[model samples]
Every structure is written in structure tokens, then in C-alpha cells.
Target: MNRSVPMNKAEDISRTWLEDFAQLLTKTENVEEGVTKTFLPDGWLRDLLIFTWDNRSLNGLRKIACYLQENLPRSVISNIELDHHSELAPKYLPLNDTLKCVCSGFKFSTTVANGHGFFRLVEEGPGCWKAATVFIMADSLKGHEELGYELGVYGGHTLSWTDVQAERRKSVEVDPYVLIIGGGQTGLNIGARFRQMKIPALIIEQNNRIGDNWRKRYPTLTLHTPRSYSPMLYQPFPKNWPLYSPRDKIADWLEQYASSQDLTAWTNARAEPIPVYDSKAKRWSVTIIHDGTSIELHPVHIVVATGMLGIPRVPSPTDQNIFKGVVFHASKYEGGKLFSGKRAIIVGAGNTSADICQDLVFHGASSVTMIQRSSTCIVASSTTRDDLLRGWPEGGSVDIADLKAAAIPFLYLKKVLTEHAEEAIAKEKELHDMLRKGGLNVSFGTGGSGCFPLVFEKAGNYWLDVGCAELIGSGRVKVKHGVEIAKFIEDSVIFTDGTSLKADLVVFATGYHTMHDGLKTLFGAEIMDQTGPIWGVDEEGEARGCYRPSGHPGLWFGAGDFYYSRFYSKQLALIIKAIQIGLV
Candidate 1:
């Protein structure tokens, strides 16, 4: 069908809904041209209602009339297509002397002399009028208020209020406890590396056990990317760390790594909205309520390592009351033990689906059907590596030029050359040779390559290949020709193709959504509006990820959106180092 046909319909719907929304917004006490509407807290309430229905429809009109007495914007009314709907008239109630009226939960004094701020409303009619409250402050009082506000009028006049709190600089010993929120490689590495840095860290897992997550993954699961590039924060996997390690081994290794480092991680320590407060002692107060006991602890910094894959959102169950059977998110799967005597249907096309499919077959399942939304760009792990290392049974090195000559087609030679230079100058011959064999070329010099200086070249393509071949070749994990799980019926699941398949279990391995949830509040609306893309660099002309429109000192963020180096741990190390040296 024509996709553009829905475009006009959607816009018309948005215009109608927003018009009603604006009328509802007029109930607030704080009034100005559009100030009341702008202050309506940014949340699902605003997001969902803004573009939901067309004001022209009868149902839409009823919804608008019922929810009208709230704070909404004036632009909404101008855009709304109100033909001859007499019910779409303005509604208002004046402040009476006998009793004070609480419009939109804002209390106004019955006597005019008692009220601090008075507002006006922009109404269309008796039933359609939208009250716009303009503040009536005496000239003298306005001057006094101005003393505490800084004004900047560029795009428009914006008053930034200065915090009136006392700047209490306290002297206290540096707190040492660290709370880690994820169990992935980043979490393990960050904690382990912190240990090396002489900092104590506590890892909290949302799951039941430490490595049980990786243990229950699909059997065909193997690391798609190479190991050398994706080194944990502290140590590299075993010397013979499979170009791709299996699912169970990755988890087992993490557990062992924690044990080896003596990390303070509590399994099942799912930090569910633990209250974190600033203390009078000038440290952070973390109230961890575990096992019915409230543990008050202070940590210098909270390192959130909940990587990209923690939140798995499934398609909304079309009919919540109906469909039964097993519906588990990828994060909760133990194995196919329950799928022993039933046909299983898996959703999503990523690595998790491949792993789950293989596991189901081995557990004596009747049949396994995989459903995917898009064709994945799958490749062998061996292809994404330092070709010579695998080529030579007993690993040795090749000259940079030799590698460039051999892997002529691959355009990554310039990167390899830069790494070679760093290795050669560091006087680390073994590392130098490793760079050479890993398809890199370099010359010893202080003056290096271009903007992407050859120096961090090897670091760029950190994990190219590892265990992808084993997963794709594994017979049990079949690549099905379908996408989008439309709905789940009682005994079968429907696909986007209008076809249904009998199923027992549905696993959604459809990767993680970008984490912008925390940013909406932490940075506020102005900053969020200026934010480019949440996870990566936006191709259009916008600010880079995590970069402030104008840099704010001491107020810095990492991990959320910025793409830095793997030795980014080293970068963090350097930052901490500078802080220690007072050179920051």
C-alpha cells in the first residue's frame, strides 16, 4: 500500500489531538503566552496524547472534552480543524468569594488580595474558551525577583534561575566503594580494572546468578566479533581464547575473573530503584535494601556498566487477556528443558535466536521455527581477524608491507600501519610483530597520519571476528524466512506475513533499545532537544553524542552515547590520574 497515504491522516490526527490537549492545559495557575503548556512535565502523558487521535472524529471529540481541563499550548488550537462542533466551546470558572476554586489542582485564594500570582485565559467561546493566565506582578516585586534571575534573549527570552543553596565544601576522606549495575564484559572489566587501580567495586546483577545468563544462551551461540579487539577491562581471555568463545565459557570466565580479582559482586543484586542521596559528609549515600536489611553505604562514584543489552522490550501483547503458554524474554531463559516435548517458536534474528534454536533441537523438541524481521548481514568469524596468525600453525609475524601486499583488497591497512609504529617505538618487539601479523603497517615517527591518526587504528576494529562460523553452521539454528511476530494466539503465533505457526515458546533476541530514559530528567528539556542521536553520531549536522552544546566543566558524561576507545578504560584511568595530580 501507499505509505504516504497515512502521512496526511497522521498529521490531521495530531492536529486535532493537540488542539484538545492545549485546551486541557489551560487549567494551570502559572500563566504566560505558552509557559503553562511548556511546564507540563515531560513524560509518557505528554508523549502518548500529543499525536494520538484526530479531533474531527466523534470519539476524538469526546476524549478531548473529557480531558480538556489541563495545561496545553495555544499553537494546538490554531492547528486544530474544528468545523461546526458546538461542544468545542470554551469552559471557565471564576474565583468566587464564598469558596476558593482549585482549577487543575492549583489553589487560588477566594479573596483577590490573598493571591500571589494572577493569570488570564485565551478562550474561544463559553464552552471552547482556553484560559491563558498572564502573571500580574507589581513593578517593584518584579525588580526584586529579577535580582536572582539571569536573562538571555536569543531564540527567545529565557530566565535561568541560580540555585540558592549554600555551597558547602566539605573535607572528607575519598569514599572507595563502587556499585556496578551490569554483568557484561564492560561491568567485569570496569570492576576488575578498578581493583587494579586500588578502588573497591561492588557488581549488582539483575539476573538470578552471576554467569547463569551466558550459560543458558542458545547452543549455537558464539562470539561474532574477534576476542583480541573486545578485551575485558583488565585481562584478555585465555591465550587460545577462541576467535569466538561459546556462550557458557564467556559467563564462566566472568565468574572466574571476579573470583580471581576478589571483586565484591552480589548475584541477584538487581538494583531496583535503590535510593541514592548526597550526604552531609560530602559523599554519596547509597541505600541498598537487600534481603530485608537496609544497608547504608557511601560510594565515591556509581559506574553504570549495564551495557547496551540489558533492557529487552517485547512487542506489546495485542490482546493481553488471551494467549497463554510460555513467553519468556531472552534474559530469563535457562534452557530448552521445558521445550522438550513441544514445538518452539522463536522471534528475532540476532545471535540469541540462533543460540536458542540450536538449544531447542538438542533438548528433544518436536520442531523449531525461527522468525526474523530482516535479513542479517552474517559472516564467518575467521574472515575478521589477523589472517596470518591463523594461517601460520605456529604463529609468527610478517612485515607491514607484506600484510598490505597479501590483504590488498582490505582497506584497513593504513590503520594497521599506525599500530605497527606504536608497537615498534614502545620497544615491544612481540607486540610489534603481533601488529605486523595482524595486517598492519607502520613506520617509526612522532608525526603520524591524518585525523584518525594511524595510532588508534588497531583499537578501532577491536572485535572483527571470533565464533560466528560455528553459530551459522550449527544445524539446529535455522535462518527462517520471516519477520515481525504480529500476535500470539492460544496455540499458535501470527507473523507479519499473515501466516501462523504452532508454538510453545517465543524468545525475542531483538537487541537492546538505546538508553535515553535517564537523560530526559538528568539533562532537562533544553539539553535533550539539542542532543543528536542517543547511541551514536548523527549523520546530519548536530552535536556529537554526549557533547554539550557548549561544554560544561565538572558536568561531564561518558558511555551513554559517545563512541570512544576500548582503552577508554585507559582514558578513564588518565582522567582519574589527572584528578589525582590536580592537573584536570
Candidate 2:
């Protein structure tokens, strides 16, 4: 058997595999037998095809076999067809350093919905292939498809567009199906999803503007991810747009996105009274205060789309009243320009602290010092961007790109990456050398998996260096590692090692508390206590307490950066839509 011969027959090979697999599924007398014949010995399945009615990522044939026993045979999926698009075609893919497999894609349908599937095949012997990983995702529900193009008001309409808009608004004002709190990217994106699905959702934002979440950030702040990596729902940034958009520009885009998407949102609004969920009716009766008027609304679902972090966490040192310099948490940090000609100290060694240190030096601060409580994982921005988004192709169809990304289960990716961790750490020899020379302790993260896992485990434990390392290496910025802040004197910040650093201003660049505490404040201990863990990976490797369930009924949590907010919020919209139509 010639090794290169399969390249010519890749299509036929994949087609045959699909035909046989589809028949194998229908003839499944037993779920265990089905898994044995169709999947690899160590197979993986990322099932979101509504058979689970929830998202699940299973590793190994044993786990997949057990899950199939619970959710299959009743699914009745059919209409399997090959998808030969450039991105989803059968080709040899280097899944990781240790494994290379032939990846192919297909489309399928269930009784009430449509879905896409991708399988990575491993050649067991000559003319033999078995699926190493299988991913199934529901694309849309039947009879509830969204109109892709705009439905303009033509000549034969009785009501003007404004009147029609008002009528549609009035209908939801009476009773909305979903109530979204906090109009950040997550809230805004979710609202768009509901509108397109014809599900009534109302967003209440405490801020005065739709994009105030971005506007209120530090003046020097900018999104490091490229524009293409984090597109808005139904809108991509202009081609000439900056790769790294400034804060003010992003704020404007978000404000325009809400208007163009026809999202029903109320700025300067908040849930006045704690929502009371009526189990009998399966609705939450809550009052919202909008600019001075209080309105009552009963919504079947309440989505808390607050920003990733809840409350700003500041350290409380003993005898802090003696300090005179300006002190604030990173959340309240205005801008470093105000500290020009002054000495500045930034506490904590996460991304926030690194940015502040850079900002302080750039703003002509006489001296800038960083205090590190623990070692931090740092990677080059270019390397991190490419590695995290390798599944996505530049300037291609995002739908296909996103699905390809979704096919890799986070847990499976983490395990493989960890096994290949030394390879990642090896490529950063120069960056680590510069950091060590700058007197800052560095790490490739726990288990030497580098910084990827820390993104979810402790979102603030790493920084993607964008010129910060050079500044620290050149001595433009100073670093103090492995020490905790002890106290503050009138002229200097005292450290646990009895050393002190004098500064005119100090900022604690420490991270914030998770949404659990803030939700507890909004919904009370009863609702909070019942909720599952928020902002971390679960046993199945999916993010916990969000885009799925939070334990309490009629409550959901939506959050993450632009990419995550889009991908996961879309999934949340599907789950909610399914629940609304009695599918789950």
C-alpha cells in the first residue's frame, strides 16, 4: 500500500466512511455495539446535536459509550451528506505534535433540527479507517429560521417602519420571553440572537449608553485580539479597520451594533426589586427602573450577562490610613497620563499590571515599579494569537471557522497540548530569557501546558506580551517578585520583606471576584446557593455555570471575551429557543 495514494482517494474514503457510519447508526441494536464499530478505541465525542439537550464533551470510547446509552436510538438522525468546502474537506491534519489524522466533515439532520458533523479518521491498517473524534452541532431548529437579509418596508404597507417598530416593541413590553441584564458584549450579542430567532428579549443596562462598558475602561486600553478574530454578531469590522481597535472606537461600534440589530434595550435601567421566580408559572416577575419610570415585566428566562468579573477586589492592609498617595483598584484606574512626572507603583503581576506598568512608563512617569505576588505565565501576543485561533482561517467564512474551532473539545485540546507542553515552552526561550534578565519570575503554567489552561482556570494569571517584556528588560520598568504588600506609609508602600518603594501613586492591578458574589447580591443567597460553579472548567471540560445551566431554573450566565461571548452565547440562544418551543 502506498502511503501517498490515499490523498487521491480522500474524498471517496470519507464518503464511504460516512455512508457506512450512517447505516451503522440506524442499525444500532445496542448503544455499546454502535460505539464499538464506529469509533476508535480511544474515541472522542463532542455532542451538541440536542440528543443530550445540553452540551457535552466526552473523552474515550467508554465515556462515549455510556453517554450514547443514555441519549441515543430516539434521536433518529438522518440525511447525512458530505460537506466538501475548502475548510471542511477531507485532508491530512496535524491535530497535535504527537498525532496526525485525516479530518473530514458531513451534514446531518434529526427529527426537529439540522446539524453539521466532523470526524477525524485514523488509519488502522491498509484500506481501514476509524473515527478518532466526532463532533455534532445543531445549526438551526426547523420552522424557526432567521431571515438573513433585511426585510425593508415596501410600498404596500399600512404602517411605516417606525410604527411597525413601535408595534413590535409594544408586544414585548407586555411580556418578554427573556430578560437580559447588563448590556456588555455578552448581553448585546444574546439579544441579537433572540431577535433573529423571533424570541422576545429585553435588555436592561445600568449604564447610560449601550457601549459604556468599553467607554469606561482606562483610556490607554485597547483590544489585543485582531479584529477578524472577534467579530460582532452579523457584522464584521470594516476592512480598513485597525487590527487592534482602541477602546473609544470599540465603544462606538457596539453602540451602532445595538441600533442596527434592532435590539430592544433600555439604558440607564436596572432590575429594581430582586426577581422572584414563580415555579408554578415558570416565570420571573421583576420590576425594572428605566431612567425614572418603573415598569413591571415577567420573563420566562433571566440571563445575567454581566462582565466576566463581578466586584473589584482590593487588598486591605492593616493601618492603611497613614498613606497619602492616590490609591485605587485596577477597575477604577483612569489613565497613566495623569501620573506624568510622578513615581508610580502597580501591585500584582497579571496582564493588568503589565499594561499599567507599560502605560506609566510611556506617560513619562519618573519611575515605574511592579509588585508580583506570584509568578505569571507570559506569551508573545503574535504566538498566542496564532496558536489559539489556528482552527480559524483568515478572511474566510466564520460559520465554518467557528464550527471547526468548536470541534476540538477544550478538555481534549488541553490534554494533548499538555502532553506537548515542552514544545510550546521551548519556542519561548528568548522571551523567557529576557524576562529572567529583567528580574521577573516566569512559568509555562502548571503541568508545563503554558498559559492556555490558565485562561479559564485563573483568567488573570497570564499576560500576552505586547512590548511589555522589552520595557521591563531594558530597565524602563522595575519589578519586585515573590513579595506581598504589607502596609503603606506616608511616603512609600511597605512590603512584607520590610523593604519599601516610594511612589506618588499606587494601583492594585489585582483581578476581580467572579460573578457568583455579584449574582448573590442581585438574586440573594437562595438563588446563588443553588447555582453551580461559575468561571471555571467542569469535569466534562466545558465551562461551568454558563451557556447551559446554573442549577436554578430560568437563570443563566453569559460572559467571556468577544470570541467566547459570540460562540457560547449562540449556543445559549439555541438552548433557550429549544426550551421555549418545548423541544427539551
Candidate 3:
């Protein structure tokens, strides 16, 4: 029997990594140890420290080694060794105390890409022994800078730090370090798309690799929506290919796209930005700490393309710690290679939950059960496939916006009419329905909610909400109402109905809580003013979800809401271009 490594329950594994490797900074000398450390000069000492990690997977160790050797100056990274026997163990160690004494400013680096790489002190005398580890220190401003480096959307640009305060004149700063936070489809697309536009962005992912999440998906997962309209910029999904690409197929395409574009440099760089608003300069001072050194950037504008799927939420509340078989968010799900013969339960009613169930079953899960709190409009892949396979003509390509624009004239004409046509029509419908019930009239007119969705007098109330109602009636899926999960009990979930389901694996395909907790802290009261009732129904009253924070300026969401439509990305790209040219 194979035993797994005892892992922390938290999704963000980097937090634990920082704690474990904090010891390595003990031997290294700080560039300047004052209350402020953000102004440290950028040089060989700063550059010599090559920090890396395996953000993609446990296998990212090799990729980090290759990245360091390829990108950094020669002789900086040496004596690389891999030990397979030491699985889940720290591979590198400090050299000796003697060498440490000679090297006063000796430094160590940690890999943010994956939690594997560590710094070492090499001493070659009297049987060299490993010495103390160094800890990288970050003061307030410095901490913010480091955060910005890892999480900042904009790439680094060259602008004198002090000169910004000295002069308020708008001057363009040339791009230097381009940081892209997300490693998802949009993030990858932005990097690829912008690189073609001649701005090379250094993409940083919290995960291990470019497409690890996609590759680990269940076998049955396929693109439910139209694929022809959905694709990375410039690179179209090949024609004659299947209308619905499997999960792995999309993953493979992303990896290939990156490889082809020579974006391997972005593989292990997990940068977080610490943004400081310079009141004097009227610009944000963003600092990014990579490995162990700070690289401050003054960007004219920042693009936050962090995708939606980062944060996972549970719908109906259940204390996860109570039962403790094996629980994880969809983001952390690797393949079910180890789950053969085990029963699994997937919760939630979205595409993610659907994929999870399909994947678990394919992985040899003994039994897989899905629990949904509400009915979803379950349109099959057939409609989506047909749409993609049969391309629409130019006239048909007019989007929802175009249709709405055309409806403006009709609305004006309706307003001008003094005959009370709408009220008359309502009266006629009521009278006709009353007569029809009495067997006096037998005319079937397609009366609806008077609008697209709200009307349904002629077709009957059943057809009004037929989509959702039928899905519940369909025996293909299990339906539950007033779902109240009591607790998780010993490889099973107990419901408020006093019913318990045996489960080997219970997945919360639950919805996602807003991933803007970090942003909330950063923006403070401004965030509340910007988001404007976060969980409320009137989402679009502001800027399409979370975009209104800056009055529709500065804030750029890559995958704000995935269901918005394919044109949303194209619109985003166009906005970015306009911003670049000062059009927006």
C-alpha cells in the first residue's frame, strides 16, 4: 500500500513553503536593513540570487533547473543534482560554516514556482558540512513591493523612482518586466497576444505549470459551449477538429502555444505585487519580489487578468473539518489515479461539478453521486456543437448588443402611442383565457410573458419556466429541494432530511466565493464603493461585476465571469489596445 505525504489543508501551499524556507535567509546579508528596504539597488548581488519553485506540479523541479540555466547569467546556478529517492523531501542544503564566514553577503533563494528549490552555502575544507539557512526580510513598503511583484498585473517598466514625485508630467515608461498573474486561458492568451503585439509579458502563475489544471481534468470533460468563437487570440482552434475539445486537448493546446512562443521563462515565476499609492506622484508604486530580491516597477497601467476559477465556495454550509475523508477544491484536484475502487460524491450544480462527477467515475470511483441545490438549464452539448460546426453568416453574427440597439426604436414608438395598447392587450389575453376555459373560444395564440421571458399566457404557465421544470422532471439527473446538508459523517454526508448517503469522495462543486479578498484589503473602503453590493442581484449596475471600482478605469478583469460570452475577451483586448493608445 502506498502512503501519501501528510499535506496541509490550505489551498495556497506557498504559505507553508515560505515558512519552511525562511531559515535559508539567515546567512544572507540584507542589502539595507533599515525600516525601509524597497530602495535597494538592483545589481549582481540582487540578480545572483536565482529564486524558483514548482508551481505547475511536483515534476516542475526539472523545469526550474532548466529556467535558471537558460535565463540567468552563467555560473550563477551550478552543481544541480536530482534525487528520486528523496521524494517530498528538501533536495538542497547549505554547504559549511567556514565558507559562510568568508562569504559575508552570501544569500539564499526560494522557488515560488514550486515549493522545492532552496539556497545553499558551499564550504570546501575539513569535510564541508551544511551551515545555517538565510531568511529574506520584507519591511512594510518592501512587503508591498514583493506582493506586487508576485501578484501585480502590469509588467515592469523603467522610470526613475524619485523623479516620479519630482515631476507630475505624464511620460511613458518603457516596458521591462511584464508580469501576468494568472496561468489560465485568459492569462496565457494575454501573454501570447501581447507578445505578438511586441510587449513580452512575464506570466506568473500560482500553480506549478502553464496547463497543469487542464491536463488533470476528468476524461469525459469537453467544451460545452461553442469552441469556434472561444480561442486564444490569433491562434484559432483547427478547423475539421471536433467541435468539443476534451479537457486534456485544451491543456495540450495551451502548453504547445506557450512552447511555440518561447514563453518557458514564465513557467516558475510566481510574483506578487505590493502596490503603494504615491500621493505625491499620483501613480501607484508596485513592488515585486522574485526569489529574494525586490524589483520595483512603475507601470502606466496594470492589467488584472486573474481568472474566476481561483476561489472555490461551498453553497449550502457544511463544516468540512467534521468528517475528513479526503476533501479538496476543484483547483487542487489532480487525477483520480489513486482513487480506484473508492466511492465518491460530488456536490454542486455547475459545469465544474459535472466534470468532477464524470472524472471521478472514469477514475474507477466505486460510486459517484452528485447533489444539486437548484435546477440548472441543462442544455446538452448538441446545441453547442451544432452552432460551432455550422458557422453563422455575417447578419447572424450580430450580437446581443446589436439586437438591443435595434430594439430602441420600437421602445420609443411604444412610448409615443397614446392608445394604451399594452393594457388593452393584457385585457384581451385575460378575456380570451377565461372564454377558452369555458369552451367558448378555441384559438391558440402564442402568448408569452409579453416579453421574451416574462410572457406565457397562451403557451400555459408550464412552458413559461419549462426549461428548469423539465430538468427536474428528467430522471437522468437527481433533484433535491430545500437542500440542507447536516454534517459529514464517516465517509458519508448526512442531510437535514435525516438521510445519509455513503460516499468515499465528497467534492464541493459549490460556487466560488469572490476571490477579491486580496483586492478588498488593497482597495479598502474604495472596494465597497467600487463593487457596490457584492452579492446582490444588481451586479451589472456598476461595471460588469467588479469593473466599476475605478469608474470603469484602471480595473481590467480577464475572466470576470466565464458565462458572459466569448466576445467579452475580444472586447477586453480592444479596451486594452485603446488604453495603450489612450483611446479609452
lDDT of each: 0.42, 0.83, 0.40
RMSD of each: 25.0, 1.9, 28.9
Give the runs in model 1 whose Cα sits over 4 Å from its true position. Answer: 1-174, 198-202, 205-213, 216-220, 225-243, 262-283, 290-292, 362-364, 385-483, 518-534, 538-566
Give the Å error, residue 202, model 1.
4.4
**Which regions of candidate 3 fall more than 4 Å away from where they truly are?**
1-179, 192-202, 216-219, 259-265, 279-282, 289-294, 315-324, 335-337, 362-364, 388-480, 521-553, 560-584
lDDT per residue (tens digit) for residues 1-584 in model 1:
11121222423433333354444444333333333332222101111112211101111222233333242332132222322222112212333233111112111121111111222232233222232221111111111111222233432534322211111001111234455656666666666555555545566665666776667665556665455444454455667878656777887887887776555666665544433335353345655545545555576555555543335666775652466767877766777887798877776654466567667777887777666554432222344344323432222222211221221111222334454544334543433344334322323322322212211221121222133223334434444564577777888777777877777777766655554445444344554454444333322111133212213222222342011223233334333333333433
- The local lDDT score (0 to 100) that residue 458 gets in candidate 2 is 71
So what's the TM-score on candidate 2?
Answer: 0.96
In model 1, the Cα lDDT at residue 197 comes to 53
**Candidate 3, TM-score vs. the true structure?**
0.50
CA displacement after TM-score superposition, residue 325 of candidate 3 (Å): 2.7
> Which one wins on lDDT?
2
Order the candidates by TM-score, highest first: 2, 3, 1
Greater-lDDT candidate between 1 and 2: 2
- State which candidate, 2 or 3, has the greater TM-score: 2
Give candidate 3's whole-model lDDT: 0.40
